[model samples]
Target chain A: MAGKRGGNLNWFYLLLTVVVLTGVGLMVYGQVGRGKTRAGKASMAPVNLAAMAEPDLIKAARGVNRGAESARVEVMVFSDYQCPACAYFATNIEPQIVKEFVETGKIRLIAQDFPLGGSHIYGFLAARAARCAEDQGKFWEYHHQLLALQNAWAYSRVPPVETFQSYAVDLGLDAAKFNGCLNSDAHADLVTANYQLGQQAGVTGTPTVFIDGRQSLGPNDWDVLKAEIERALGL
Target chain B: MTAAPADHAPGPPANRMGIALLALIGLMIAGYMAAYMLGLLGAIICGTGGCETVQQSPWAVFLGIPVPFLGVVGYGVMLGTALLGLQPRFLADRRIAAVLLAGAVAGFGFSAYLTWLEAAVIHAWCRWCLASAGIATLLLGCAIPEVKKLRRS
Candidate 1:
């Protein structure tokens, strides 16, 4: 009787193992397939253009401005350095926009900080770090560095102040001044001010953008952003 | 639940079964987190908490592999060892006891480190992660005496 029971248990074990392996394999394959399709199609999360209200720029604060002042289309961007979508925009799309629209004297780009608070532990500190770099007139360089190395420090088990300082040192900024600025909360108010600006504009997420201070766009894909810019330029 | 082989030092089969049960519980918790990491699950039902924040953090991955995946592997090994040790043929084998004990120790240490990270570094608590750590500690407790009995023989 014991022998017969063991024989039956062996079949059960083998069947269970096979089922578990097959289920896990299919789930992984499906996720990978969907990820590839999304990337290949360049499809982005949709935004409701009609629901986007014009943010009151007059009451909101702004950050560093890039491009020609005479540019007719002013693109105001609210972003968080620790946000993945915002990182994608900064790393992949923003440079292209700069080359085409900003350089061509068609648009002025303004960057505003919007740390998502509890969701991103390092977002506000990262914003302050960027502003500290701005003290040496290297805000854009530091901003790019932050997004590029986001994976390195964003989930760190320690406060990433030293890593932020290293970026400043690499950018040839005064290390002591940068460290002092970061540690002393020199730019904390500026970051807070920008956060308030985002809130007052009804911004609920990172990477939110407004064109000509009237039209809002969650520009996740370059094609969509470019088309919107071209339309704004009457192209 | 068969009787221990006569040559063995008579470690209770119940302890081995308990270890296996704890390991299975740990595996389920870790597997759920792994599913979330893989994007198969939309959101963790952590109830207005920091599960998303903690799981999305950099510490959630270790050397390019997701930490929860590592948890799944660790618990799976422990479960396998415990099940095999329970078999009549393997009851006398000290190697099975050693492997289960080693796995439990490793899991406990890793879970403790993650718990510390949540409290001190990430400043957020993931209930699933906390539960896994608790289970790992229990597994370690169950394995120690079994290994000791095996060693005495």
Candidate 2:
């Protein structure tokens, strides 16, 4: 009886060993895959710009934009700087969208601000910081940096204005001008207007997205957004 | 605690193996977070949307190292001692039990502190961090039996 019990225990050990080894193998594999993707995203390839006719919606939107203005489909994203889901959309999904549709001239992407003022302490400030970066024609660059490095300043105890300025400096923006703009809240009204516009559009939380003037896809689901974009393009 | 009596047998093999397995799981959780911290991973897919917030908070780091990396080290030690305790040559040794108990106590205390920080201070909870805390608690529970057996012996 004791011998049988030992044999069963040995089998259990063998199974556990296999499971643990497999788990480790999978983790290492995942890390390698993620490393390659991170490298690909690190380059921040420039977007292809085309000066097509600006649509009325593009003219009405109060935020930064990319892609040909005449692109058949419009994607307007209402996002907050401190929101994680928005960060995911910016870091993971937006690149693919920019590569596939924006560069290809099939879609125009506009990012509007919707800082959840009550919840995220620095959301409004981060939005203002991005606008300051925009003053130097580096809105997209500074925008991506803010989302990608959200963790660095999102929950900081003190205001992250210096960190915001440092990011501008890193992007090779005119440090003196960017600092002046940020310190004076040069774009406070613009950010506020965008927030009011988002509220008017019935957006309660970020990152609420509208494709071709119709609300679409929850945050972080790239495949769904891709399909919606395709359907809008009638492709 | 005094040195374990020389005549004491090592912990039951089942308990040692259990501890080892749990530590391995804890290591994986911490390893994932550490990788995320280092930017090897893209995003943390969490339901509550608080994982990144908690991780990004100033409290996420202790000293100069990320907290999860410290978790990786602690769990690694637990795993090593548990596996070593399973070896036949070490089966009669009590030092492994002592090390495991010490590690478990430290881990449990640290996990509790982090959990409190999540609730009381950070006001955000990362499920992965919570899961790590759960694993640390389990490690403490698993280590207790062996140490108790050593004490009685």
Candidate 3:
């Protein structure tokens, strides 16, 4: 009886082992072959830049807040939309600074593009998209939309030209004009100019803010920023 | 008259093989955990926040679960199975050893896929991830011979 049981047990183990090994082989093959499908799907999306406009920021960009200016210090922020830390700073820190400084006319915020090439594939496109929105007087609105969708861009294998357009559409932008602005090489030059300027200013990474030409090394909270602004202005 | 057969009969060679496999797995788990922790610390010190970038990437979450957390659970399960095999009271059936070997093979295959993604897609290598892959490969390689032995018996 014991001899019979041992023989049966051996057969069972051999069969199970084969099955497991086969399953693993199939999984590895599938992963390598099918992983590129996601990238293909992303590439097929339409590239419409007009879909990214925001009404509130568009109006402000067109000089509606021109009369509300406060301080004389110009704050130039060199940023990449696909950068997560930049997104965090834009959401958590930029708002307060804008409300207290930019909105109050104490500072004029100038956004400069500085896309990192290695990690963020669509970073340059997003920067160009923001500039395209600028032509329609919706620069700030488009900026916020790009930063808010940073994660979407970072993980996307294909460039997110279409995604940027969707943001313009949500903001009620003119589709034809937005598309024209996006496709034109005009904005590309502007993005390149910003990149050159950023490099010349010794900016090495995204979210490198220059308050009157002095670099803010990292994402500084509101208090440190406020102090910097005051000191820069000799107030 | 011949000496009586030794009382212990040196338990089956299969049991000894199982213990060795388990010890190898434990070593792998420890090596990988240490590498991951060190990589994270380096990223933090550099101020580039590369660690967050690597961690938040879609590859970091396989099937919506954190990979590191999954690794921890997998190692624990493997350790338990090894301990069960080591106990002398329970018969060290070849079938049980085969099943465990199969699991190790599956884990090795998955680790290979992850390593490919790290190189081709993510373009950033996490030293710890590489260490895990290496360990999984070694464990599977050693288990294959044991599996063959179980089959012949």
Candidate 4:
């Protein structure tokens, strides 16, 4: 009688074990499927128009503006407009930094191109567009447009050159000249040079802001940036 | 007669070890779940949404439900099973106790896989997740000796 009872208990335990394992396997399947769905959704989203409109003034072999630069301290911003973190900083942090410091002439902000080629294909082109806009004296206007429209081109499998051209036209730029500049490899060297300069300056990631040539490695809110600017300015 | 008596006498020790290990696993699970809940709440309150981003990521959901919620349920089940083993009638069944420990072992293995995913693929660490993994591992380790003894008996 005892032997029969033991056998019954064994069978019951085995059944429970199988049920638990099956539950775990089902969970793994669900997780993988969800990840694929998310990836597909991300791929279908529309390109960001605001990002293309933003000006990227920093180019290779470009000399620093020594005279019109009114700030006491020089703040170099090495950024890729396509970078999400850069967009976050632009939207959440840059405005306060500009208002409290840059506009007040306490810090002169210098923009540089550090396009991450593999992930953000249009990053360099976007940088070039901003530089071309700078030639037309509308750098900051274009800068705002690019960061604002960052997600516009995010999902595009192909680079959106025509979209950028439209932005140049809307900005009252000479379309013929701008289109030629966009297609020509003329500014490619400049973009490469700026990337190299950023790398040499110990910039490991996007939106790396250098205050008086000191690298700020991580995210810096208004107060932290202001304090660094003050220290750099000897104030 | 002497040999048969020795084999039967082995039942109490196996039962005691299984219960002790299950209780320890229960405590660990409770501690981790509390931490995760607190962290999730803190993230929501801060308005940064970094916590939400981490939570919403593919890693957050295992199967269909949130991983934290699963942890909560798994830990509760473990505690319940351990309490069941404490009853006089349940303690007499050595085979049943061993099977319960085996299920706990399986839980430990799954938790290990999740921990690997978090550290390597997700490239993020959640302290509560780590604690749960650690607790599950300890429970499995404790159950091993008891399981071996049961097999011998």
Best by DockQ: 2
What TM-score does candidate 4 reach? 0.50
Q: Put down candidate 4 lDDT per residue, A1-235, tens digits, no spaces.
A: 1142122234434544564566556546755784575344321322222232223423224523321376677777777777666776677777877787777777777778888654455788998888887878877777667877766753355777888888888888899988888888857887777877765555556777777666552343555666766777888
| Model 3 regions lying over 4 Å from their true place | A1-69, A72-75, A104-108, A153-158, A211-235, B1-53, B62-64, B72-103, B116-128, B145-153
User: What is the per-residue lDDT of model 1 for residues B1-153, given as tens digits with 9 covering 90 to 100?
Assistant: 475465555433667777877777777678878987875653121112567657866789998999999988998888888778767667658888788878888888998999999888777788989999899889888988766656766
Worst 10 residues of 2 chain B by lDDT: B40-49
Q: How much does each candidate deviate from the true structure in C-alpha RMSD?
A: 7.3, 9.4, 13.9, 14.4
Residue A214's lDDT within candidate 1 is 45
Model 2 misplaced stretches (Cα beyond 4 Å): A1-61, A117-120, A196-205, B1-49, B55-103, B109-113, B116-123, B126-146
**Whole-model lDDT, candidate 2?**
0.78
Which parts of model 4 have CA positions greater than 4 angstroms off?
A1-60, A63-68, B1-153
Model 4's DockQ? 0.03
Better of 1 and 3 by DockQ: 1
Task: Please give each candidate's TM-score.
Answer: 0.62, 0.57, 0.59, 0.50
In candidate 2, position A181 carries an lDDT of 88
Candidate 1 second chain TM: 0.87
Which pairs, if any, clash in model 2? none
Off by over 4 Å in 1: A1-58, A63-78, A82-110, A118-122, A132-137, A149-190, A200-235, B1-12, B38-58, B86-88
lDDT of 2 by residue, B54-95 (tens): 786668898988998999999999988887777765654778
Best candidate according to TM-score = 1
Please give the lDDT score at residue A132 for candidate 3. 77
